[model samples]
Target: MKIFNTPSNSSTISGFLLLGFPCSRKGQILLFVLFSAVYLLTLMGNGSIICAVRWDQRLHTPMYILLANFSFLEIWYVTSTVPNMLANFLSDNKFISFSGCFLQFYFFFSLGCTECFFLAVMAFDRYLAICRPLRYPTIMTRCLCTNLVINCWVTGFLWFLIPIIITSQMTFCGSKIIDHFLCDPGPLLALTCKKSPVTELAFSTLTLVPIMILFLFIMGSYALVLRAVLRVPSAAGRRKAFSTCGSHLAVVSLFYGSVLVMYASPASEHKAAMQKIVTLFYSVVTPLLNPVIYSLRNKDMKKAMQKILGM
Candidate 1:
């Protein structure tokens, strides 16, 4: 019997070489500096939000609590890729160990999945606060909010565990060179000795299905929210409602828009450079921009951040 359990000819492959960005020595140094600055800024921005949420008594609410948690998630989310990417930029070999690559693949995707669930939960929170304000306090109690947060983390981490394990066990042969910065499923699968169409389909389904469902849920919530806002007698009240939701919608747009494009079709269909840009956008740039979007659009958060900064 042909055994799928054992690798055919890839046993010697100990690691995968991540090609990172195609740039000159000078360009690499410049990119290293640029991404380093961005990484530091992203950490500080998200950290400040968490601090602002924790220290500000006036900001102690479900929304802010969710925001704080999301910020915390973003911190680790970016960490899962940026530091390694920075290291790759400086290193000549640009080699990541076999296990290390898959571990990164797992954590990066798991964290991203968590972020998706968090976004959907945040949207739900907004729906409750805006559509059912009277019962919001009673329904979305501290206990429930905490449970929801826990559920997001648990569900997200668990969601991709089986798929990652299955993918890791497959036989990877020939070239261990991944053309992208990170250990993505597409590049890894492309290196496998045997083509597993079922595995590819599972990965695609896992990546796209949850995102679509969450996006649709967010849209449905906003539709009802829009309906309610228009019925408000006062323009000021409507403006307040829109202002509150605008930040989330902006974040949602930035995240979902890029991810949808990245995963809409097979990654092989996309140019390597384009893949890198899209992945970098959603993974690195989005996290950096999230805190700014929230802090600028949210007056309460702005004030809280200002207080923390002694402004």
Candidate 2:
């Protein structure tokens, strides 16, 4: 590995200047209240899931273990964006320093990638439980579960590091004003003055590989699960099996579908709004809905909740 010199001068970042909705005071206030409420609900919902999982012994299986991890990650995911967004909404200058922007991207991308990998892992766990129930205990052993969780975070962290380093190296001599409420890779790349063909290639490769690999793994897992579901003798057994897998499949579809739309779509001038809306799905709305989706559909989760709440 080649060593790079660290710049001695403390890089000055003017902080991020968020260009939130409508450039007016009233607009900012209204937006702030709305996002704040969303933020509160995201925290409360994900937090409750984590607490319930930890408190209830019945929820100690691999599936709920990963759900608890998802709840925790969703809390941080919202924290990474919502607070800064609210601040940007109220402030006169939404200017973020170059360093601050990269830092934000690093954490945001890390958590986002982690969620993707965790979701895939959760799907595989479900597949094992439903399709291979006889070996579920041995298949998802304690050591294997620990390794799987660690690998997800480690892989996600590594994947985001490339973008952060490449983006950091590029000079930002041009306009610092980013259009979106938060710093995104698409907009940040657009802002750089330095030539980044190599960086762009690297970013694309990094983004594509895990997505392709995970997509195939998820598909294969679901295929086997479906095959197993169909072979069950009783209708009630099939329904129970399908019910367990449906929520995981739904959450996965929502996540990957929105992401593919956002990044893979054309980069025309009009697509900025489309990109923002897609980003909102994964970053804000998805996190809020994940716990709700998992809780409402799963009978075990409902019973666990009832026990946790002393109902």
Off by over 4 Å in 1: 1-11
**What digit string (tens of lDDT, one per residue) describes model 1 on residues 1-311?**
12234354455577899999979999999999999999999999999999999999988899999999999999999999999999988889898988889899999999999999999999999999999999999999999999999999999999989879888888866787999999998889898888988888987887788889999999999999999999999999999999999999999999999999989877778988999999999999999999999999999999999999899
Angstrom error of the Cα, residue 270, model 2: value is 6.1
Clashing pairs in 1: none
Summarize candidate 2's per-residue lDDT along 88-108 as a digit string, tens digits.
788887766656677788999
Best prediction by lDDT:
1
What would the TM-scores of all predictions be? Answer: 0.96, 0.91
Looking at candidate 2, the ten consecutive residues that score lowest on lDDT are 1-10
Position 137, candidate 2: lDDT: 97
Q: Using TM-score, give the best candidate's number.
A: 1
